[model samples]
Every structure is written in structure tokens, then in C-alpha cells.
Target: MTKLLVTGAAGQLGRAVLNHLLETSKVSPGDIVAASRDTSKLADLAAKGVETRKADFTDEAGLAAAFAGIDRVLIISTDDLATPGNRLKQHKTAVAAATKAGVKHILYTSMPNPDKSLVSFAPDHLGTEEAIKATGIAYTILRNAWYDDNYLMSMPHNLETGTWYTAYGAGKVSNISRDDCARAAAAALANPPAGSTTLTLTGSESLNAEEIAALVSKASGKQLNVVHVTDEQLAGGLTSAGLPDFLVKMLVSADANIRAGNFDLVTSDFEKLTGSKPQPLSGYLANNKDALLSAH
Candidate 1:
């Protein structure tokens, strides 16, 4: 039996990938390994016969040992966005471990056009991608777009304030659903492509901030307006709004990326991999309206 391990299995994306692998791909639970920093968190997966292991990226030896006997491993990007270069270090360690363990293939969840993206998190991804390529292992790079639910982070505030503040002036983003990204990653893991393959998984529609605001207005029954501002102004506002400096910078960079048109490209890779159209923002908002309202 081919052994496959998914890092960050305790995270939402990791859980989605594992679920798709088992329930949709019909992969044997015994053949899959669900690894996280805390193995105990994966007890449910373990109960289902999926191998559970502790694979903390900071612990190099432990990470290598976790990859032992695994044929292909999916390296989900860490959520530690506040620390500078910490994620890159973790990714490098994971790649080194996978290499040392002689894993055949290394799959990574990355941002769309990391090399060209203006998003603050882009460099870490580009660095990880370069590191993975340097290892000379067969690789699959899934450049995922921003999740559709990401917009919902502002929904609560918008509902109360009636204004959607952004720096993305007339720029469009092809954001896909987190579930779709996970499903595509799971499908790729179950039947990986020959040699190195890089796919950009994006939503079917490319929408601007105003368009998103219009959708929110329709969903919430509130008059929502997009307030476009300069990047510096956006940073200042978010910082004054009680957000941490690091997060303010990250969010500002993401909007700058949108302004630069880095996220405007639409692709059929998601459907090509999952055999279904990517979910639309309307359906996503309709289903999660209540949750969006409570996000504040």
C-alpha cells in the first residue's frame, strides 16, 4: 500500500483534503497519514484507521521521522503569518525532512503567482517553491487563490458601518472556495501528475471590491459601499482599528496585490482537477450569511 501523509492535518484545509481523499476519492483510510503538531488532535482520524503522527516543522528530526515510509506528502502552508520568515523556516525544514526521508513527491499549497504577487505572504511561498525544486524531488505546486470566505471577515463590520474599505481600486480577484482548493489538492494527491506539475486553482468569476460589496448588500439587506483608499491610508486605518501591525501590513499587501492585477487571472484548473465548476460567491454567501453576521 502506498503511504501518503498530509501535514497540518488539524487545520481546516488539511481536514478538507483528508476528508475528500477518504470520502470522495475512496482512498483507504489505512493508507493515509494525518499529521499535525499535536497527534492527539488527530484522534478522530486515528479512530478511522488513518495513521496519525506528530510532525512539528520546528522539530527537524521529528518531521523527518514522520515522513518515514511515506511516498507522497502534502505540505500545507502554516498559519503563522504574524512572525517574519518563521513560516519559510518551517517550510524549509519540512522540505529538508521530506528530502532526507526519501519521499518521492512533495506537494505544496501556495498562493497564486507567488513570484509576482504583491501579497506579503508571497515571498514565503516563492521561497518554499524554490526550496522544493532545489531538492530534485517530483513535485506538485497548487497555487490557490484567496478563499471566498475571506471577504466575510469584513462582513460584520460592513453590516454595522455600511462601508467596505479596501485598497483594491477596480482590480478583480478570482477567489475560490477553501473546500474546492482542498478537493483539488486531494485529487492531485490520490493521482499525482507525471513529473513536476504546477496548477493555479481559481474561482470561475473574477470580481472587484465593488462587486463583492454589491453581493454583500444583497445578502445582508444593507446598503454597502466600497471605500477605496491608498495603500498607506489602508494600513493606517487598519492599525487604528485595533488590528495588530503585522496583520494590518498583511491585509494591506493583499489589497495591493489585487490593485496590481495579480489575482485577476481566471483558470479552469480547479474544474480540470475536480471535474466540477468552482463554487460561486453567491452560493457561498447565501449559505454562510448567518455565520458572516456573527464573525465580528
Candidate 2:
């Protein structure tokens, strides 16, 4: 069995990737190492017989030790939205650790169209991708599209006020579920393809802001309204939402990129890798509708 090391094990995507690997792939629990900053948070995974390690991206020595004896490592992008450059350091640490431990394959989850793509948080991902390329290890880059779960917080607000706000204008986004992304990651982790490959994991179709509003309205039985705003207003709103200045700027910039048609198409890359078509927006709405409706 190929040993796989998964970073960010406590996160939603990481958990789903491990679960999918257990259910759908040939990887055994004994061959998996789940790493996180908080080892206590991974007690359940440990109980399942998988080796659990505390590997901090900031701590290179620990990472190198944990990566020992692993064949592949999945580098889940860090969540420090305010500091994009910091994650690059973390990724570099992990890369060096993998190199030291002689790991042959490394899977990285990155943002789609990250090369001067103008998306919020694209620079860090693009930089990390470059670093991974420099590492000389075989790499598989899953350039994940916008996640459907991003709507979760907005769903409650939209349902409550019957208004959905965005800076996307008429630009389309092939939003994908974090679960499908996880499945794709699991598939890649189980079998890291030859060479450095980049795949854009997207949904089955593309939907603009207005189309999503319509779908959300049907799912929630609400009079949903689509309100397109300027990036300035978006930055202000994010600031009011208590986001740091850096994050507010990042989000506004991403909206600008969306309006520029950066994330505006459907891709079959997910299906090509997973052997199954990605989920539809309606399916996500239906499955998550109850929670969205109840939230406020």
C-alpha cells in the first residue's frame, strides 16, 4: 500500500479527502498519516488505526520527521487569508521536509488560473505551485475552482433579506463542492500521475450571479434578488464584517478578477480524474438547503 501524508487533517476538505480515500480507493488506514497543528483534534482518526502526527507548517523539523516513511504528501493550502506570503513559507517548509524524507510525490490543492489570474489569494497559490515545481518531486496540482460552500454564510443572509450581493457582475463561475474536490484530491493522492500535472477541478456547469440567485430562490422559497456592487463597496462590506484589511483587499480583488472573466467557464477536469461528473449547483442547494434556511 502506498503511504499518504495528508496535511490540514482537521479541515473539511482534508477530512473528506481521507474519507474518500478510505471508501473509494485502495489506500489502507495504516498507510495514511493525518497531520494537524492540534493532535487532540485528530483523536477520532487515530482511533481508526491511522497514524496521527502533529506537523506544523511553521516547524520544519517536526514536518520532516513526520514525513519520514511516506510515499506521497498532500499539501492542503493554509487558511491564513490575511497573509498570503506566509503560506508560501509553510509550503516551502513542507517541500523541503518531503525532500529530506525522500518522498516521491506531492499533491497540492491550489486555486484555478493562479498565474497572474487576478483572483484573490491567487499569488500565494501561484507562488507555491512554482515552488513545488522547483522541488523536483513528481507533483499533481489540483487547481480547485471556487467552492460552493462559500455560499453557506451568504445563504442565511440572502434567505433572511431576500437579497444576494456580489461583485461578479455577469461573469460566470463554475462553482464546485468541496466534497467533489476532496474526491478528486483522494483520487490523485492514491495515484500521483507521472510528471507535473495541473488540473482545474470544476463543477458540471457554469452559473453567473443572477442564475445562482434564481437557483437559490427556488431552493429556499424566497424572493431572492441579485445586487451587483462595485469592488469598493465589497471591500467596505468585508471590512464591516470584521475581516482584516488584507483579506478585504483580497476579496475585492478577486471580485475584480471575476468581473474580468477569470473564473467564467466549465471544465471536465474533475470528471476526467474521478470518472464521475461533478455535482450540479441544484444538488448542492438541495442537500444544503435545510442548513442554509435554518442559519441566521
Candidate 3:
């Protein structure tokens, strides 16, 4: 049986990957290992017959042991915003462990344009990607696009304020659904390409702030007003909306880059990887219309 180890299994992307892997494949759940900092959190995965393990990446021994008999390792980017350096260190440890265990492939979920991105979390991804490449293992890099739901979180706040303010003013983003990213990951894990593959996954089309405003207007029936604000205003807005200081700075800078058109490009790489184009944003909205409406 082929054994696949998935780190950060408790996170959204990790959970989505595991769910799709279990639901859509002939591969038995037992052949997959779902690991995280806390084993108890993954009880549902364990109950589904997935081999569950408690492998905190900070603990070198635990990480090394976790890769034993693993055929492929999917390192979902860690979510420690407080100290991303620690997470990158953890990724390095996991890569070493996978290498020692003779794992055939290493898959990573990384940000697009990691090297040049002004995204606050770019360095962690770029460093980890560099490490993975240096390992000489057969690898695949999934440069996931912006998640559409990121806008949904601020819906209530942005609507209440009567302004959908962001530094990504008129910056077109080919945003794809997180579920599509999950499906792409599953496809890669199921039938991984032989050498290193770097995929820039994006939506079917690019959309600017105006397009997004129009969609919001249609989706929620709100006389929602769109305001293209400065990076400073966006930073302040984010703070007012409950973002932490560090994140506010980071995101504001990213929005600046967005204005520069860094994240405006569209790509067919995801379809090439998954053998199908991603589901459209409209479909995502329609499927989750009830949830979106309930937010109001």
C-alpha cells in the first residue's frame, strides 16, 4: 500500500486535501497519515481509518519518526503568524525527515510569486521552497491563488462601513476557490509527476475591485459602495477590522504590490495539473449563497 504523510492536517487546506483524498479515491484511508501538533484534534480523521499521528515539527525526533515508511509527504504551509521563522525551521526538519525516510515525493502548498511577493508571509514560503528544491527529492510546488472567501470574512465590516476598501485597488486577481486548490492537491498526490513541477494556479478569469464590487452588489443585494483607498487607509481599516499590528503592516504592503499588478495574472496551470478547469467563482457563490446571506 502506498503511504502518504500530510503535515498540518488540522488546517483548512490540509483538511480539504485529506477530505477529497478520502472521498474521491480508491485508496484506502489507512494508507494515508494525517499528522498535526495535537493528535486529538484529528480524531475525526483517525475515525475515518486514516493513520493518525502526533508529529509536532518542532520536535525533531517526532518529525523524523513520522516519515517512516512514508511514500509521499505533503507539507501544508504552517499557520504560525507570530513567528514564521519557527514554521520555516519546522518545514526544514520535515524535509530532512522525509529525505531520511526515502520518501519519493514532496508536495508543498506555497504562495504565488513567493520570491518577489510583498505578502507578509512570503519569506517563509520562499525559504521552504528553496530548501525543498535543495533536497533533490522529486517535488511539486502548488502556488495556490488567493481564496475568494478572504473577502467574505470582511463582508459584514466592509458593508457596515459602506466601503469595500483595499489597497488592491483595481488590481486584478484571478482568485480561485479553496476547494479547487484542494482538488488540485489531491490530483497531484494521487498521480504525482516525476520531476519538480511548479504550478501557478489561478481562476478562469481575472477581476478588478470594480468587478468584485459588482459581484458583491449582485450576490447580497446590498447597495454596497466600493471605495479605492490608499495603503495607509487600508492598513488602518484592517486594524479597525480587528487585524493584529503585524498582519496589518504585512497585508497593507501586499495590497501596495497588488496595485502594482503583481497578482493580476491568470494561469491555466491548475487545470493542467488537475485535468479540469477550476469551478467558477459564481458557482462557489451559488453553492454557498445561504451562508453568504446568513452573514448579513
Candidate 4:
């Protein structure tokens, strides 16, 4: 039996992927390994007979030992953007450790258009991709699009105010749900392609800010107006709201990326992988209406 390991298994996306692997893909628990910095956080998975390993990205030897005898490994990108280049360094360490442990196949969760994306962390992803390729190992790069769940961060407040401020002039985004992305990732890991491949998981349809606002309004029974502003104005507003400098820059860069039409991409990669279409934004909004109304 081929052993599969998922690093960062305690995170939201990692847990979702593991759930799909067990419940949806029907992979045997004995063949799966869930690795995280804190093994206590994965006690539930351990209870299910999935092997839990302490895989710390900062320790190369520890990662290598954790990856021993594993056929395929999924390296979920770390959320260490507080320091520039730190996340990429961690990814490089993971890739190197996986290679050192003689892992046959490697998979990664990346962002859409990392090479040219306006997101501040695009370079980190691009650098990590380059490092993975340099290892000459069979790899699967799942470039996930913007998650519809991301809207929950600010949409509730926007909905409460009846106004959504964005810098995306008319550009659209093919926002996929975290669940759908997890499903696709699980499918790919369970049955990887013959060789290295890069797939961009995306939603069924692309929608602009106005279209998104309309959907949220219809779903939550609220009137939401989209107000367009320049990137500088948006950054200023976020700063005035007391958001940390790093977070303000990331959010503004995302809006700028949308405005530049970089995020207006639609692909059937998710359907190809899972043999099913991803849930549309309308359905997501309708299902999460109560959460959308609860301003954080």
C-alpha cells in the first residue's frame, strides 16, 4: 500500500483535504499520515487510525524523518507572511526534506498566477515552485483560486453597512470554495497523474464585484452597493480602520490584482479532477447567508 502524508494537517485546508481523503476518496486510514507541528491538535485523526507525525518546517532533519517511507507528500503552504521570504524558506526546507527522504511524488497548494499575481506573497509561491521544480521530482501544483470563504472576512460588515468598497473596477474572479478545492486536492493526491502537472482549480463562473454584491444581497435579503475606489484609497481606508500594515498591503494588493484582470480566469480543472462542477458563488452565498449576516 502506498503511504500518503499531508503536512500542516491541522489547518483548515489540510483538515478539509484529509476529510475528503477519508470520507470522499475512501482511502484507508492506515495508508494516510497526518503531520502537524502540534500532534495534540490531531488527536481526532489519530483516533481514526491515521498516523500523526510531528513535522516542523523549521527543522529539516525532523521533516525528513517524518517523511520516511511515504510515497507521496502534500506540502500545504505555510501562513508565515509576517516576515518577508520566511514562508518560501519554509517551503524550500520541506521540499528539500521530501527529496532527501526519497519521496516519489510531491504536491503543493499554490495561488493563481503566482508568477504575475499582484498579491504580496506571490513571489514566495513562485520561489517555492521553482525550488520544487529544481528537485526534478514528480510534482503536482494545485494553483487554487480565491476562495469564496474569503469574503466572510469583510462581507458581513459590508452587508451591514449596505456598501461594499472595492478597487476591482470591472474585473471578475472565478472564486472557488475551500471545500471544493479540498475535494480536488484529495482526488489528485489519491490518484496522481502519470507525470508532473499544474492545475488551477476554479469556480464554474466568473463574477465581478457588482455581480457578487448582487448575489449576496439576494441571498441575505440585504441591499449592497459596490463602491469602486483606487488602490491607494482602499489602502488608506484599511489603515484608518487600524488594520496592521502587512494585512492592509495584502488586501490592497488583492484588490489591485482583481482590477488588473489577473484574477478573471475560469477553468474546468476542478471538474476534470473530481468529475463534478464546483459550487457556484450564488449557492455558496445562499448556504452561508446566516454567517454572511453575522458581522465579526
Question: What is the alpha-carbon RMSD of candidate 4 to the true structure?
Answer: 0.7
User: How well is each residue in 147-166 modelled by candidate 3, as lDDT tens digits?
Assistant: 87676776655655667777
Question: Judged by lDDT against the true structure, how good is candidate 4?
Answer: 0.95
- What C-alpha lDDT values do all the predictions have? 0.92, 0.86, 0.81, 0.95
Q: Which candidate is the best by TM-score?
A: 4
- Steric clash pairs (candidate 1): none
Q: Report per-prediction Cα RMSD to one decimal.
A: 1.0, 1.4, 1.7, 0.7
lDDT of 2 by residue, 1-296 (tens): 77899999999998999898888875789989999999898898899888999989998899999899989999999887766578788888888888898998989999888986886678788888988899888999999988988888677777787876789887888899999999999999987677879899988788888888888888887878988998888777778979878867877776787788888867888877889998888899888888778765
Can you tell me which runs of candidate 3 are displaced by over 4 Å?
A: 294-296
Model 1 weakest 10-residue run by lDDT: 287-296
- Top lDDT: which candidate number? 4
CA lDDT, candidate 4, residue 182: 94
- TM-score per candidate, chains pooled: 0.98, 0.96, 0.94, 0.99
lDDT per residue for candidate 1 within 18-116, as digits (tens), equals 999999889999999999998888899999999999999999999999999999999999999899999999999999999999999999999899999
Which pairs of residues collide in candidate 4? Answer: none
How well does candidate 2 match the true structure in TM-score terms?
0.96
